[model samples]
Target chain A: MDIFNKMFGKNNVSSKTVAKERLRLVLVHDRANVSPQLLETLKEELIKVISKYTEIDNSALEVSINNSEHSVVLVANIPIRVRRSMNTVC
Target chain B: MGEVIVVTSGKGGVGKTTTTANLGTALATLGYKVVLVDTDIGLRNLDVVMGLENRIVYDIVDVVEGVCKIKQALIKDKRYGSLYLLPAAQTKDKTAINSEQMKQLCGELKKDFDYVLIDCPAGIEQGFKNAIAGADKAIIVATPEVSSVRDADRIIGLLEAAEMDSPKLVINRLRPDMVKRGDMMDIDDMIEILAIDLLGVVPEDETIVISTNRGEPAVTDKNSKAGEAYRNIARRITGENVPLMNLTIENGFFQKLKKLIGLRDS
Candidate 1:
């Protein structure tokens, strides 16, 4: 099945789907007026900053900019996995 | 005297020209003399959109340059006798006409027509500045997408900075199904973000494309949903109270059956 069928069943691609995809990319670009390369650089810099504080599951963490109506937000989602030996050391 | 209103959007391809053409036609059909001005110089499309490109002998540049009188450039619409068009000069750049010239032209147009609708170009540059000058009101057109909404917000700020009165908002190409599915921003969310008076909401209808291609505005078609929305907007412009169109999708049979069994009303 195609991506549309897999996600929204057999119905035709609705305006909602189009709007969602368009808004996601548009908001990303509008937030900082930055290209995807710049976003990647920012993400890498963010990972470095967080790593200095604590051990994080960097592979699963998401760091990005969100464009809200009133302002732009830097959203960072970090996951913490506690090893038993590491907890004992703490 | 006629009220001059400029239809503007900061982003391109958001249907600013379409809204200007349709609203002008709608107002003319309502017995008001209306003139639609194409202000997108060098990339003029309103003349073609309004089906008056071939009929233009002189344009706004000719009027501003004193090559021809304003009366010579105004092309009357055959369908609506009171409706006319002041076509833009495709050969000249936007700098050919400054904000002062535009204000003077609109001041002259106000003496003859009941409504002068200026179709502004995209972007926040000299062209946009020229379009909004000497306008008593403004209509900001925006699609439901984030980019269009963001551009519209920027345009609203510029209008405020120009000391223009509160402009009405027209949310175009909205899909009811998307709002219901939580996939798109609803009308309330858009209003909350923009903080402008809601003028009208137009659904995404394929008939708009067809009518536009045929050089006929969808507003004249009684069967078109978008047309009805435009007509309602024109009515509202004339200080009439018209209820908003019902663009919600009908509930499916299975959903209705589930609701009945659950004794829920939605």
Candidate 2:
């Protein structure tokens, strides 16, 4: 069954779909004039702001610009190492 | 005054020159006086594409530099009496003509021709600036590839920044069979991502190469599918309500077999 699934899988996406996905992401960045350097700086700033409330795994954080149906979205995925207590928050 | 439309693609080899040549010929066939200007200095090919290379006595550089009048630089088409070509200078670089000079030249041409189609050079540089300097409209040509679409997106932003709003798009060299097989980007995929008004879609036809080799446009061949597509595009440019051409390939015996085995879509 695994071999059959490998040969013909429902999870297999067409190359054009991959191309479309890539183009959507790239165009979102291109249209916003957001360079890789700008995203890097943005990631650092996001880490700085989020670090105040919790300890984050910076190495695992991912930042990117995605295109929604109507507008552009800034997506950030950050792993939390620890959450500050109420006394520490104050 | 007649309108000036620049045919441009940010990346080369995406059929800008071919689009310009075919559309110009098609429009002339529609009884409009058209002139094609090649703006790719130091790498001119529109003349060869139009089969008017041997008659180039003067070029755009000569006209802008006051060495020759614009009329002396214009080359009459071999077939279409209403079609003309302004060849580019092979020796001169893009710097030879500035934006202001191009604007004046376009103004002069507009007085005589019903449509002035400028074949723009690839990339976003001085040549591109010169190409769009005097145009009233812009047409962007892009293929189905990621690189072409990415560059086209950048070109769209640049065109908007230049105050040229609502530039139409032409998807060139699209393979319908590959698209049907889900191996290539479809028209909707391009239109949705680019988010621009589609002027037309030219299929991947070998006749375009043959027509270019013969120095004649595909629009002159009634049997060529690409020619028919260009005709529809020309009508659309003239504000006619022409529907998009059907791009479905005929399902044959092999196609039936493939579909039966779940290798092809229904």
Candidate 3:
């Protein structure tokens, strides 16, 4: 794809695109008044809460803010090891 | 009553003073009585930009501090009789006047002038607070860059929190050539990110520097494109429905042919 784009010169990912994408992500966090430290705290709390229900790989967890056309989302990718039954957890 | 508008930007060097000077001059040219208030106190440049720096007998500090009347402090423009400027005190800092005094001063100015444009200082500090204190409307000036747009977004958030009417945006210093080359962000990108109504877009022009050097606003020059943009913005402020100016670079025959033959991109 890179070679094809280089040959045809159809690369639309201009510097402006990169700037806009970066701005979109930054502003979502800005307008929401959520700092990077706050996000870190939220990630830690999420790991804590989810650990009771499932055996999850906290080291492999990822969290980020994704901006769509009309809305922003807090997306998390957590690697699950095993589901713990309520009786077993209790 | 006159309408008080604050020209502001969160970041420095974004043409806030130039916009205030030009828009005030344009509004005055439209036969409305206008007074430009320089609220940037110590770092005053609106006077220099408007070419009234040498004539400042008294500043905004004097007027607010009861040392001089507002009339005595206002310097009449050399060109337009209806246009006057209340210059900032070069010695005094932003703390010289607070929000309450600014509100009162704007209230008093509104009774006599048709428009009062407050040139706000850079940063989201006391100067910003004082500039927006008396404003009925706000115009956020920004350039089409990542830092400027981010600051503009932050300013918009601050304005909304203060319950000021949704501040309008003026995208300044846009380079059409760079935008065409995909090296700069276009108008739509800024408007989408800022999420504010665009007041006007001033193309990047060297004429602005020349006009500032001459201490005469570009709006007074018949040939300056930046001047024409400011005039359109003034008309829009008066509730006129002027369309955005065409900013496309006129292509020559060879360039057109090259684009037609797919040898070059638009």
Candidate 4:
């Protein structure tokens, strides 16, 4: 189910949903003042740090910039695939 | 000095001039001296829409070029005592004026009128720069289409960079029926995406066409929904706490029947 949702990628055939996704993606890039390549670099860096301790689902990472009434925020939501014990903490 | 507001949309044909015209007319009716300046230089429409086209002897170019006094170029509205229009030069294009000249004109107009509303041309270009150079506020108009919304978002970003704080949003020509059928975006969706204070929502009304053809704004009609929306917007501009006009689908019997039959009202 999760994988299917990922395949659909928070967007469906509905025009409204498509518009929402498009606006979100463009606005995130616009507000962060960074290219999409930078976001991929951030995702890679995040994976490198996390993979040292626990196995992670590198494919299901979501990094975006969202705006509020006061400021724009960089938000990261990466799915964890496995957890390692503290005995192997890095 | 008066308030200088720029009515702009990055996309064309989203009712920017109509909004400017109606707002100026409505504001004047509320007893404020308002001047509507057309900054769309070559493609002037404010004068025609305001029914003061023939009275234009001197235009914005003349005033900006120091060929005529600014006062001489302002044509008073025939219906409203306090409303005036500084027509754009039809012979010249947008390149005829620069930001500094526009700022000067706005400064001069602000001292005399209670509100100076500039009708901006579409696109993020020199004309847009000139329109907002002296503006104290911005009102972005856009239809509910995805392309329109996208352009409006871009305009908002540009306005923010221009240091024009809190540019207001006005979603124009919204069709409630389409929204209900899930074919179009609702007002909340637009407000969220644009992330701006929504000043007003003007419903799609055919009366606008009739009035525009007659060289009269529908704001004076009082019977049209779009007119009422414009009136509420005008009052809001005056610092009144007017509620947003409801443009929700009525869901009447015919509408329900159409829905049951999987048909939409044309």
Candidate 5:
């Protein structure tokens, strides 16, 4: 997505999209009443715990709050490279 | 009991006072008794906008301080007999009154008025707290700009934390031309960002400026599109299902015909 954004960044980037992207980031942090530093702390803790079992994509990890029309959702997307070893799975 | 609605925006100059004045006037014109409370202490403007500024002998501070009765502090509107103004004190700070006093005052007023519209001061501060203390619901006002919408989002969070239910949003000063060109934020974009039910949208109309300067709400000015939007909102508050007005440039009848016949691209 970053590569895609950079490829046609000039003509394709509308002010509305910029506004949406910015708002999305801000509202997510705000909705949870969780500071960015706190989110970082949460992310690190989760990574340490998960990486103990399997190879996790730290670069691809995304943790944020999502606000729908009626509720606030805490969303976490952590990509796993493979299944855990038998020791952890068992 | 009357519903107490607080009109607030965390950012200033986004038209909270104006919406309060116009909505109050519209509800009053519909034959319901309405009272406008200027809760922006020390910098009150709702009375001035309602054209009842000069009639103020007592204010919200006075009523809370026991200097005057609430009825005495309530000033009758120059135009609508059923409408009234509870002006905020010009010399007092936000500390002069608290939320408990506001809740009591609103409780007293609820018995007599059909709608109590509170004009909240900008920011998530003491004034904002006092204004929303008694409110059963909230109406957040914001513009299309990033900063304004950001502040509005913050305020909405506060409103919910204060236990106010499902605060509606009103997007003010929307420019259709800019929206059509994809330059400015559209109403749908704002609703998506804010994640709130849109109460209404008021297009940027000069009549609101002219009318506010004259200390009269624009809703009485039939020709103003902004005024029409506000009246519709007032009706919606009273449980009427009014459609959102299309502020886009009108297509001529022939243009519509051509589009219908697939002769022109939409």
Candidate 6:
């Protein structure tokens, strides 16, 4: 009885979860009208632009899109590595 | 004259018709002359929900097409003498009535009635445009679920884009037990996500289904909690200071203790 109860308890699908997923996807598309391909292109361009300023770890850098009902947010994370000399050049 | 208000939900089966029927009845009970217009066109149900489907001899199309006058098309509610219904055309599609025609009809109705409540069709389509054309305010009805709330948010945005002022919200069919268990989105969470003024919250009551089946409004039964909530919404619309119904809090030990100690305050 306990096993049956545990197996069936609170595992039902909810409308709220479905709605949240739908809204998330729709908002992502609705904000900038940017397709996934375009996002990839944007990420590549962002990496190229940031490389001119500093040595950015290309593999570690990330760029993506975040959206809400009213606005689209472009998020980018760049990791910069600097090498320090232990002694002055002789 | 009082303003025209449209009760709309972008998602179907979220109780837009039910809310419109109950609110119209409640408003009329308060001595306000209210006219509930069904703008669903071919898929009309507001008339049936209000139990006036059998009486719809001349519908909105007849009035729009000049076959019958608006006065002839309007059906007075059998229960509430002050309430009226302008039903949709069952045979015709939504394309038959344009936004301008709806605006004109509502304008004419405004001369006679204090409140003109339009029951908008689901989706952001021609029917929706026609429904909200002449409304001064909007009331978005949504269930506690995310899909309903998301649709409502979209509808609210559409209303804003149309230059309509702050649309109030009605979160319907909220199951408080699920909310307490952290299974469902609480009222506060919904309000936070939607960012709108809350008109009222209606609990999921089986009495609503029974009453709808009987072709009677749930509000007519005073003993029903959902009925009381609808009445309170009516009172609020009339500029009364009716306290919001707290669905999350049951009227049991905690409530009684708070009241007994005079700690209960809005």
Question: What would the TM-scores of all predictions be?
Answer: 0.75, 0.91, 0.91, 0.82, 0.82, 0.81
Candidate 4 vs candidate 6: the lDDT winner is: 4
Best of the two (1, 4) by DockQ? 4
Off by over 4 Å in 2: A1-11, A46-55, A76-90, B257-266
What's the candidate order when arranged by decreasing lDDT?
2, 3, 4, 5, 1, 6
- Candidate 1 residue-wise lDDT, B1-266, digit = tens: 99999999899999999999999999999999999999999999998888887898999999999999999999999898699999999999999999999999999999999999999999999899999997999999999877788899788888998999999999998887667755577788678667899999998888899989999999889999999999999999999999998988788787667655654323
Model 4: docking quality category? acceptable
Every model's DockQ? 0.13, 0.82, 0.83, 0.36, 0.57, 0.25
3 versus 5: better lDDT goes to: 3
Q: Which docking category, incorrect, acceptable, medium or high, applies to candidate 3?
A: high
lDDT by residue for model 6 (A1-90), tens: 234335669445454555556666665654456677887888788888888876778888777677656777877888886768535445
lDDT of 2 at B199: 94
Better of 3 and 6 by TM-score: 3
- The TM-score obtained by model 3 is 0.91
- DockQ of structure 1: 0.13
Query: Against the true structure, whose lDDT is highest?
Result: 2
| Sliding window of 10 residues with minimal summed lDDT for model 2 chain B | B257-266
Across B1-266, the per-residue lDDT of candidate 4 in tens digits comes to 79999999999999999999999999999999999999998899898898888899999999999999988998988688799999999999889999998988899889998999999999999999999999999999999887798789889989999999799999999888777655678889999888799999999999999999999899989799999999999999999999887777676898768755757685
lDDT by residue for model 6 (B1-266), tens:
56899999899999999999999999998899999999999999998888887888899999999999998999999698799999999899999999999889988999999999999999999999998999999999999876787788788888988999899999899888667544577777778777899999899898899889988899999888899999999999988988978676566787657655757323
Task: Give me the runs in candidate 3 sitting further than 4 Å from their true place.
Answer: A1-12, A68-71, A83-90, B254-266
* Candidate 6: segments with Cα more than 4 A from true spot: A1-41, A44-61, A65-72, A78-90, B249-266
* First chain TM-score, candidate 6: 0.63
lDDT tens readout by residue for model 5, B101-214: 999999999999889999999988899999999998899999999899989999988887777899999999998866764668998899988889999999999999899899
Q: Chain A: TM-score in each candidate?
A: 0.61, 0.65, 0.68, 0.58, 0.60, 0.63
Model 3 chain A is weakest, by summed lDDT over 10 consecutive residues, at A81-90
lDDT by residue (A40-66, candidate 1, tens digit) is 887788779888877888788876777
